[model samples]
Target: MRLSRYFLPVTKETPADAQIVSHKLMLRAGLVRQTAAGIYAWLPLGLRVLKKIEQIVREEQDKAGAVELLMPTIQSADLWRQSGRYDAYGPEMLRLVDRHEREMLYGPTNEEMITTIFRDATKSYRDLPRTLYHIQWKFRDEVRPRFGVMRGREFLMKDAYSFDLDEEGLKQSYEAMFVAYLRTFARLGLQAVPVRAPTGPIGGDLSHEFHILAETGESQLFYDAAIDDVTREELLAADASTIARLTRLYAMEAEEHEKVAECPVPAERLRSRRGIEVGHIFAFGTKYSASMGFSIQTADGGQVHPQMGSYGIGVSRLMGAIIEASHDDNGIVWPDSVAPFQVGLINMRADDAACSAAADNIYKQLETAGVETLYDDRDERGGAKFATMDVIGLPWQLVIGPKGLEKGVVELKRRASGEREELSLETALARLTAR
Candidate 1:
């Protein structure tokens, strides 16, 4: 993508309403714009990042043996009513009435709808174990939606529903998703700690919330320091035993930690920090199926309610959570895996014929090599171009200038660390395009 043609509206001044680091940085970086109090329109740069995150979530879900299918944003109110949650769900539920005098709603979650679909489609015990997932927009009427996408009323979510014949099957599906969440966060360059959490409105007996540590986080957490020692490789290689081991580690939110009279970890081993929740999984046996009278035939030919579990990863909120955990004073320090563009190719002297030719040649080489590069061909000052590159936070910046070209070398700088190296144009291209 060329910056000259891109619709990036980056600003130097931070919005006064943005209280958190992610919200402020997101605005300043021109990733998103607020259309309403709790709704945001994702700009071009922001949409790229959002889609990248969504794809990662989708890939991880697929690895967990979940099949993908899309669900509608709007759902029939009769679904929630059958689940007995329409009245009890409170103001967050965006209730609506259609012209035909029928009730409807923008679904906050798809437990009721998914249950109906799965129940009507499967009748025999052969379809006992199935996990279906969807990446879609969800809406909830938050009373005070703030902190940008972190607590937005309208957001993208990756929700997976697992249907099993019994409690044991549900546990297996839940563990699979738990491990999937760990791997997903690790790939996204986040250290997510899974802590036992209350089911709340989901009404599950077993639940876990995955949180990323950040000072600006809303939830206070007490966890074993050993949790931090686990590497991304270890998480990616995780299995049922690894999942079992991780769950045994001490990790809980403030509310849950306060309920315990005896703290398990030694004072030195126990660490306290603030956290932003990015994912949640619930093993709610027969909650939706029983409530909605959804039943299937068992092996013994008896009617039985299928056990269900729901897993959710906040696809949109992750951008804010990642920024909160990764940004520095300069701007966002995007993880290479989730970065919109792998390299920011800067024509430092766009007005100079030599610099423009060199930068343009390198950009063409990068494109041919299948690199996602954002070439800054704008007729702007070198300082402004550099600043834009830093704020957007691509993993690398390749600067082309007349002086460097005259010396037969170009500058390659890593965004995370302010480290730069001057190498021959051929060498720099080789380094970037190397697999």
Candidate 2:
């Protein structure tokens, strides 16, 4: 993508209303624009990052034996009514009356709808276990939506519902999603700790929320420091035993920690930190199924409600969470996996014939090598181009300047470590493509 043709509307001045680092950086970096309060228009650059995150979530879900299927944003109010939660859901749900005078709603969650769908499709015990997921936009009427996408009224979410015939089956499905969540966060370059959390509106005795540790998080957490010792490799290949070990480790929100009579974690082993919630899973058993009239026939010819679980990852909120966890003073330092573009190819002196030619050639080479490179071919100053590159936070910045071109070298800089080295054109190409 060429900056000259791109629609990035970056600004140097931070908006006065922007309160958090991720919110401010997202605006300054031209990742998103506020269309309404608590709602955003994801610009091209931001959309790329979002899609990358969504794909990773999708892949991890698929690996965990969950099948993918898209669900609609709008759901029938009758679905909630059947589940005995229409009025119970409260004002956060955007309830409305359609043109036909039928009660309707923008679904905040799909428990009721998914239960109805699964129930109508499966009648016998043959379809005992199934996990289906969808990535879709969800809306909640937040009274005070703030911190950009971190607490937005409208956001994208990956929600999966698991249906099982018995309690034991639900446990297996929950564990699969638990492992999937760990691997998903690890793949996104986040150190997310799974902490036992209240089921709240979801209504389940078993629930865990995956929170990514960040200084600016909304929740204070008390956890066993050993949770951090579980390596990324282990998380990627985590099994039921891994889940058991992690669950046994003491981890809780401040609210939950306050309720405990005595903490099991030794003071030395207890680590308190702030964390932002990114993913949550609930083993709600028959909450939705039973209430929504979803039941299958048993082998003994008895009707039984299917045990169910719901897993959710904040797909759009993850962008803000990642920025909160990863950004520095300059701007967002995006992880390679979720970076909009892997490399920023800047023509430091676009007006200079030599610089332009070299940058164009290098951009071609990078693209041909299957590297997602954003080429800054605009007739802009070197400093401005460099600033844009830094703010956007591409993993690598390849600067082709007149001076560097003359010396048969280009400046290659790594965004995370701020490491810069001069490499010959061929050498730089080889290094960038090798990965």
lDDT of 2 at 57: 98
Per-candidate local distance difference test: 0.92, 0.93
Candidate 2 lDDT (Cα, 0 to 1): 0.93
TM-score for all models, in order of appearance: 0.99, 0.98
Give the per-residue lDDT of model 2 (tens digit) for 1-435: 888999999998889999999999999999999999999999999999999999999999999999999889989988888988998999999988989999899999999888888888999999879999999999999999999999999999999999998999999999999999999999999999999999998998999999999999999999998998999899888898899999999899998787555999888898999999999999998998888788899999999999999999999999999999998889999999999999999888878887788789889989999999999999888889889988889999998888887788988999999999999999999999998
- lDDT by residue for model 1 (1-435), tens: 889998999998888899999999999999999999899999999999999999999999999999999999999999999999999999999999999989999999999999999988999989979999999999999999999999999999999999998889999999899889988999999989998999998998999999999999999999989898888899988888878778878899998777554988888889999999999999989889999888999999999999999999999999999999998888989998899999999998878887788789899999999999999999999999989988988999999999988899999999999899999989988988994
Q: Name the regions of candidate 1 deviating beyond 4 angstroms.
A: 259-261
Superposition-based RMSD of candidate 1 using all C-alpha atoms, in angstroms: 1.0
Query: Which pairs in model 2 have colliding backbones?
Result: none
